[model samples]
Target: MAQNGSAPVWWKDAVIYQIYPRSFADSNGDGIGDLPGIISHMPYLERLGVDALWISPCFQSPQGDAGYDISDYRKIDPLFGTVADYEALIKEAHDHGLRIIADMVPNHTSDQHVWFKEALASEPGSAARERYLFRDGKGKDGCEPPNNWQSVFGGIAWTQEPERKDGKPRQWYLHLFDSCQPDLNWDNPEVRTEFESVLRFWLDRGVDGFRIDVAHGLIKEKGLPPYTERATMVGEDDDKTPSNAPMWDRDGVHEIYRAWHKLLASYPGDRMLVAEAWVKPLSRLARYVRPDEMQQTFNFDYLLCRWNAAKYREIITDSLEAMHEVGAITAWVMSNHDTVRHASRLGLKDAGARPQGIDAAHEQPDEALGLRRARAVIFMTLGLPGSATLYQGEELGLPDHTKLDRKYRQDPAFFRTDGKEIGRDGCRIPLPWKADGPSLGFNETGELWLPQPEQYKNYAVAVEEKDPDSPLALYRSLLAHRKAFSLGLGALEWAPERKDVVEFCNGPVRVILNCGDKEVTLPEGEILVASHAIEKPGFLPANAAVWMTEKAE
Candidate 1:
């Protein structure tokens, strides 16, 4: 059990592993992963020692934005499986003493959704049209978009409806992401009531909670004002978001969450909600987790922090302080489906840089250095006083498929940006479960939606499971230690300042990370586990981290 020792609050100190359903496994021998594939791997997840699983969206989608463009909230996509498959997955996960957190997308729905279809067919100012953001074009002829807001993918945010048979002027609809994903107008009471029921639909089916997609974007600023600033992808900005940005992190978003929180509280099993808010300024982000709102939010600041010890220290301190103020636990993340794998990202020439995608022409990441740093960081993250979200394949030390060809790219961001941005396909490639196979054991038929890199063979779980020093082994050990010590629920204390190193104590365990090139002398304690082997006694290698307990008197 996790530190909280209560069914309702397990998330507060749990290590939740994120499973990108499309690429995790394919039990049906199809190229794409399905719910059955996930059920087949329950034992693997159970052995991983994570307290819960945060499965990415598998709801009926048009595959636009890779499942973010949800079409039907109540139905599971056939590509993944049917409703029975999802129910079985939930049951199997709970059977293994694990909790399941579904990805709920309330901000927008696919243009193919029934609501959007009805809205498109209905006349302007009708209730159907009111469900979404539809407005007359600004110019007299109504050919121009209502506002200059740009989509997060690319181009203008508004898309004009097709010409009508009656020859009436076309109206434009707002989509912060791709054109296929029309943003819902939360101002409509009907929208609120419908989404609340959507939450209940999943909660009733036995899901432990939800990881709310674009949690900060549900409510746009009133009047839908034009945003003149350059548009950037989500989770890219490090500084504070402008108060008048027009769409993101608006104060009204809290009301929606407060009601959802109440709905969740009414249910049994301590059902919870986690926000994927990419909002800035630690204090502002804290508001999402205030007493009556979400229980947790992803700590993107920690994920974006550079490799420098000082930067890591600052991010950790600020994150802990901010969450403490709200009486909520912090959730630390190193990588996810949306970002480049840390094993590759940390090894880049610029450790702080977050490229949209990597191709053959891109400068190659330093694999050895990146894997070394990744191991060290994971050790540090596990020892911290909060929940840790481990992305799939990170335990196998997987890196981005940097050489993925453009022809195979399916991310909407790629097409929307006209190939200027490579998109996230490289990171979403299927996981390698075995060392020798046509598709690295992702499926029986060897078919793959995205090609796997040649190097993936070396990182396969089958190969890692037999190697004691592998990242997989290290993760199991770290998780075991974390649970035994209740580290996630313990307090963090900074060790004496040291040059080019981050040292901290969580309960009886002390963690030391060496960011400098030179070796550091070991402290007086019994070594528990180290990211790298210590060639010489009493010395820690550069870019390595170790956990230790106090020596007996």
Candidate 2:
């Protein structure tokens, strides 16, 4: 029970902060963040007022696709730390009143995983091969891929194996993502049984929940079929139609979740699971949280919405309505490890335009405007009646490091696209902890896996901590007020007085966010806080958000 049993669910109003372990902090000066580094920063997180921390994968991996290509789901990677270190981090996080949610990537496993290696060594049709989606080639001499499906990173989704020991024809395996990461056959009982055990392993270590990676993609249709509609790796086309591909948001996925729900229910501490589902139609997304499945799913629609008041209101309404219909709380997210930083994305001329590759580095963006909108969008997102996620550095208003040198880029998307797509590395740069330290206090080595921009000095935590009006301060203040007002558990009512403004009431608090090009008048009340300075009384500047006490009718 939480919030005196009124909010009952722990995740309903929790502000969960996502930590990309490789970038958050580095202990032992390894030039990469580790669990000890996370442990050391517990105080900082506690002060930030987040209720939980969703750390990205740190499982034993081959450094392929970052840590998502998990080789051993049961063990922590030496790059991060050992299992004992993870347990320590979990205990410390709990001590600080922060719930720890491990990332469970069940959709696929690293090519180097024992299961995958066994599948490759074993002949086709063997039990070892049955654990994954292994198929035979289809064309003359069986050279072509089983189907026309494409990998999310680029190229064919199916990879042909070397000649088998039995001297049989070449076999192909499905890898919806990178070829180094092979998709598992969720239809197999062995696969299901193993993951259920993996869940218990982490749960036994006292994890509060799991953020299931690629949750909608675990189960594919019985017979793999190519997506008739155009498909993108990021699933941008998923909204065009319901269930477009054999591999995405299939009906069978729910059965797996229902089983997962049962396991989580058996555990103590109200353990939960959230889906990183990119499905379309809030209704379809709602199915993942049908009282007996996932507790929440990322609202990608809100993250992709352009800078428009009407668009924001519509998506928020749809998200809230759909979640309410299913008796689940909505989860709002703006920036994450995969997407461009919202601050930088908002500065671009087109908020929804995704620029990629080295050429995109030269694109001129209005950084000031972007930071303003980034600050304002928090009010809109955090003001909504549900849980919200904050990426590591957004509280400091860090923009995407769009100008990273191409040689330093390591995202599979970049290599797969032959450097044509710079990928998500720009947003994954290590966080700046102190303004004056070598490597900006990320590590004493003055080196990082990915180089940090010299400009990061201004956005460093040390710099922002000293400024009362900094984005960090605003975040801390807003979060404190959010708790004080119970904004997360409050009821939402739209108050549309102007087309350029999105206004809503969460309980007794009124939030007004203006996204238009021109400033607009706002209703008078006890002004709580504004994203940008109020240039004139009774008015809100363009791309600004203000929260105030709701006036009596």
Estimate the TM-score for candidate 1.
Answer: 0.98
Judge candidate 2 against the unseen true structure and give its global Cα lDDT, from 0 to 1.
0.88
Residue-level lDDT tens digits of model 1 in 206-309: 99999998888888888987779644545344653454577888999999999999999998777888999888788989999998999899998888887889
lDDT values for all models: 0.90, 0.88
In candidate 1, stretches whose alpha carbon ends up further than 4 angstroms from where it belongs are 1-8, 233-237, 240-243
lDDT of 2 by residue, 1-553 (tens): 1335453677888999999999999998878899999999999999999999999999999989989999999999999999999999999999999999999999999999999989888877999999999998998878999988877787788899977778778989999889999999998999999999999999999999999999889888888876654335353322443457778888999999999999988877778899998887789989999988989899888887888878888888888899999999999999899888889888988864455532344675688988989999899888888899999999999988878888888999888878766788989999999988779999888879998888899999999999999999999999999999988888999885588799999987899998888889888687888898997988889889999995557
Reference-based lDDT, residue 388, model 1: 88
Any runs in candidate 2 off by more than 4 Å, and if so which? 1-7, 228-242, 356-362, 550-553
**C-alpha positional error of residue 427 in candidate 2 after TM-score superposition, expressed in Å:** 0.5
